[model samples]
Target: MGVDAARGLSVIGMTMVHVGPNSAEGLGGAIYGFPHGRASVLFVLVAGIGAALLSRTDERRWDARLRLFWIAALFLLIGLGLQSLDHGVAVILQHYTAFYLLALLLIPASPSLLFGLGIATALVGPIAYFVLRRLLSDVVERETVGWGDGLGDVLAGLVLTGPYPVLVWGAIVIWGMWIGRQKLTYASVQWILIASGIVVAISAEAISWLALGQYGRPDDSTDWRNLLIADGHSQMPLWLISSIGSATALVGIGLAIGRRWPSAIWPLAALGQVALTYYIAHLVALHFLEDRLRFSDVRHAAPSAMMLAVLGIGFAIAWRRYLRRGPVEWIMARPFDRHRRREASQNPRP
Candidate 1:
């Protein structure tokens, strides 16, 4: 159930990210900003919570860890394959897999240790990056390589090109795991997270404004530095802090709102349940639309709205009727089947 919620948030975020601007001026634009980024963070945090939950289920911790390692490898391979087709190296699932592999070793530690690690990563990772960038900016620019060159370069780029977000993201996961272990219900956590979220959200935004700057009203061909340094779009440092703060608030709000009217968000949740499917599907669909259908000339607003509506409706319908796991998720779950079967068979020993 928690996994479903996380997946739902991911799908919604991916859709908005891919679609860019939409027709509706107010709601759609806001979704594209802090909300979209926050959704991605929530997805990662919940992933940590799910991982911790899974670790507690059985005694074969080594086998479980191996399974996760392979799954991460698979995601990395998929990302490589997609990049080969010139799809760009922003494949987040690959990053998730990589983080999960790293987190597996840390999963067994005490909550305080995990939390401490989270705080350390969140604080220290960016400082290290800034220092490295100051020293290596010229060299890094001189190399000037894309991620698709090879596995080693891709791995290296993954580490060097923006490891801070992943570090903070991993921290969120650890934090979620710590939260998940508690004996609170969804409702109770919602209120607590909401109140805390607001405080964090304000702090994050303030830090973002101080570190970066505010958006200078939307326009075509906005300056790259402005975008990079702007409140919602900045990277590392301010980006990590602000996004985390906003994400905390949003998750709290989502849970609170979800409790009040579950049905209102049933569609969003449904879309989330089949997130991997929807994510890959969106990429493929966009490729076809732009490359084959020749919609490359179309404006961002109309096409984005159309695609968002189509994806939302399609996923909601699929979730309402389907009983099986999403195709990609099912493929990812294959490593667990052997253990599940062994457990099942052991339960009724002959």
Candidate 2:
């Protein structure tokens, strides 16, 4: 159920990011926010949640993890190809693919260890970013190459620009895993999450104000790379606060709803059941509508509304038709199942 809600939220976030503000208009833009960067953050955090949940399931075998890694890699390749063809070189999927691989490796660790590592990574991530920025800034200045040079440069650029968010995101994943291992109905856990979320959100906002007052507007184009570093007091803090706050709020809301009306879980569950499929489907649909059809303007309204309606109705229908898996879910599961069969054949005693 929680997974379902997370999936639905991810779709919402994706829609906002792809649709952009100009197209969305007043209410739509307000609901999503300008730049809509936070939506992707939410999607990544929920991804952590889903990964944690999967780690707890019986399907958490080596072959299963490898297959998932390959899937992420495939997406990463697609993202890279798309960037090379359409946009320049600022694609995100390569980083996502790297993060996915890292998550797969870390997912099997004990929750306590994972949580401790998450905390350590969060604390160190910014500092690492700062140091890397100094080094990379030199390279960029010396070479006089714009950030979007070659694919290699872009990949390197991501090491400094990209790793920080993934570090924080990895922590969120660990936190989700810890939550997954817990007794779900505990009131104290809920209170703690809510309180922590509020405090973090407030702190982030306050810091952002301070930074803006001292350094200038958050979007000031002094050096685009500085935004990724901690010294700038812009992107890092804002991202941390917003992502953590939104993720916690989501968990709190899900728990509250789960307790209040159990049957309300259906739609979210249906969405979650086919999360990977829907995620890929969204990319494909967005590409088709905006790129192939050349109806980028229509994307402002039609795509989002159509996606929402389709997902809602499709989820309802899917729930009735299939008891456990979504269409994509069933497809992805096959490779893992085959691997399991091979393992079973080798070790028949178990």
On lDDT, the leading prediction is 1
Q: Give the TM-score of candidate 1.
A: 0.78
Q: How well is each residue in 200-258 modelled by candidate 2, as lDDT tens digits?
A: 75676677667667776534324444443332123353555556566666665666566
TM-scores of the candidates are 0.78, 0.73
Candidate 1 lDDT tens digits, 88-200: 32556667665777668776777778767767776666555545555666533312133357666555455555432453355566666665554334777767766775776
Q: RMSD of each candidate?
A: 5.1, 5.4
Give lDDT: candidate 1, residue 152: 69
lDDT of each: 0.58, 0.56
Report the number of the highest-TM-score candidate.
1
